[model samples]
Target: MTSDIFAEWLKRQGHLVFKTKSSYWYSQAARTFQAFPYHRVIEPDNNEINEFLKEHNGVALRYSTPLSAKYGKISYHVLFTQSTYSIEGLPKKARHDVRNGFKKAGVEPISFERLAVEGWELRLDTLIRQGRVRAETQSAWVKQCRSAQDLPGFETWGALVEGKLVAALIAFSGDDCCSILYQQSATDYLRFGINNVLTLAFTNEVLKRSDVSQIFYGLHSLDAPDSVDEYKFRMRYTASPVRQRVVFNPRLSPLFNPLTYSALNAVHKLLPGNPTFAKAEGMLRFSLQGKKPLAEQDWPLGLLEQKESILKQY
Candidate 1:
């Protein structure tokens, strides 16, 4: 997909994104604090990054994979291939849970041409408050979701029990890939494994499409919670390390060092209920300076190789 379209999508999702002469900016704000997830550079080089850093008063910019290693640090993500994945590929326990979930919920998955945005937002908000959904929601996000029905390649797949929506997946299809951008289910149905059922149903629907070969489930770090990581692993996603970059503001150097960041992160974990404080803490941690630069040559060639293997299997 073109950066222009992706940037527009980000805006539609309530992120403050804009294109610069040489890069795309994704500005994130929490309360009164502002930060950038990373600048997407058209032609990434040391000079371009330096220029961008200068423009942003030395705020760090994140880039993906190989280029990130050359210009920053390394991170990782789990990728799920839709073409070769099926319910049978999941772990026995996971498969059983999904099957049992459908039986218990007494509902079959349904594809929706469009779902009511306000209702969807209310369900999502309820899930978020219960900590079942990790994503933060804003008022603008709900407004954007309502407007997104007119956007190309955007779709929502949902499951209802006796006419009450229990689970939903918001997806976006690009030229060659389909991404599950957001997912939520009612907290009351967690025991019934509605999350698993929704995922399976959504994947099955995507598999029916002839245009997409891969499904991107966003990012997952090695240190991610066991519940989430294991769920994705059981669903047969392949993990690969991708590079990430951070450039700290020189004036705030002391507060943005690794040691300080780790300590603050510990404190932040204790204050989960205070999102404004948590977000401020995250900004400091994200802007921390790495002790050493990652090696550039160690790009995850295995990710590409794995993708090729999956294609061959198909």
Candidate 2:
């Protein structure tokens, strides 16, 4: 797959993205650059990172490096290895959910246009459930999905109950990696097990491809609760190990040290509710913690289990 398609998709969403020797870095949260594809562990030379920062007016650049590489916080890629994926292989409780979901909803590939028009409600429900309604607006969500329309390598899948969309996800098929992005399901349908059915069916479908070898659930989230990805783990995705690096502009590096992170974390805890504040605190915390050796850093929960499955393959 042409990786540029993902970058193009992001650009169409009105975000600025730049390319370096190692990967495509996109502007996020009004001032930060985040590397995409989620699975790429890059080795960017310091000079290049410095040059990019200089050119971008010193916006922070965040990317992942191998655990053995220098400077980053301990985090996981949260992935599923491509193998014989089946509901029969899922844990007992999850297997039950998938079975029930299949009985209740129809899983199928839908056009991005349909997602743009009908996905708004599911998106809203999801954000509301997560108390992240401020993270995205309905118009923005529709525009984002609509922009991916007809984009190659981007696929839309949904679990429909009585022909109404209850759960949906947008999967980008990168060469050797299928990244699942923007997954949301209606809260009421949790009983119907729509998320289980959609995740299982979509994941199985992607793994069937001979070229794709892994499915990325997402990065260890910077702000959301761990339980968000815990669901994916329940559905059989491994929290694959990686070091998420936050490369700050030299001029601003002083503001991101341990003391600053500690103070920010304390303030955010008391403030609560605002996503910008929460993420700002999380990012600073990651930047500070990542500078230490892995032995000294606190690892994200479950990051080691089945991690070798990806370290060996990717």
Query: Which window of 10 residues has the lowest lDDT sum in candidate 2?
Result: 305-314
lDDT of 2 by residue, 1-314 (tens): 36789889989998888888888888888478888766888989899999999998755888888877878887888788857788878899999999989899999999898999889889888888776777788888888888898798888999999989999999888778888888998889999889999998888788678989888889887888777888898998887678888888898887778788778888888877677888888788788888786667766776755454544553
How large is the C-alpha RMSD of every model relative to the true structure?
Answer: 6.3, 2.7
| Pairs that clash in candidate 2 | 72-290, 73-290
- lDDT (Cα, tens digit) per residue for candidate 1, span 185-228: 67677777777887777777778888887777755321223355
lDDT of each: 0.57, 0.84
Q: Candidate 1's error at 43, in angstroms? A: 8.4
lDDT over C-alpha atoms for residue 122 of model 1? 44
Q: What TM-score does structure 2 among the candidates reach?
A: 0.93
Which 10 successive residues of model 1 have the least lDDT summed?
31-40
Score candidate 2 by lDDT: 0.84
Residue pairs whose backbone atoms clash in candidate 1: 38-62, 60-247, 75-242
Tell me the spans in candidate 2 whose CA falls farther than 4 Å from its real position.
Answer: 304-314
- Those runs of model 1 whose alpha carbons end farther than 4 Å from true positions after fitting are 12-14, 20-23, 30-43, 56-58, 67-74, 104-138, 221-226, 250-255, 276-290, 293-314
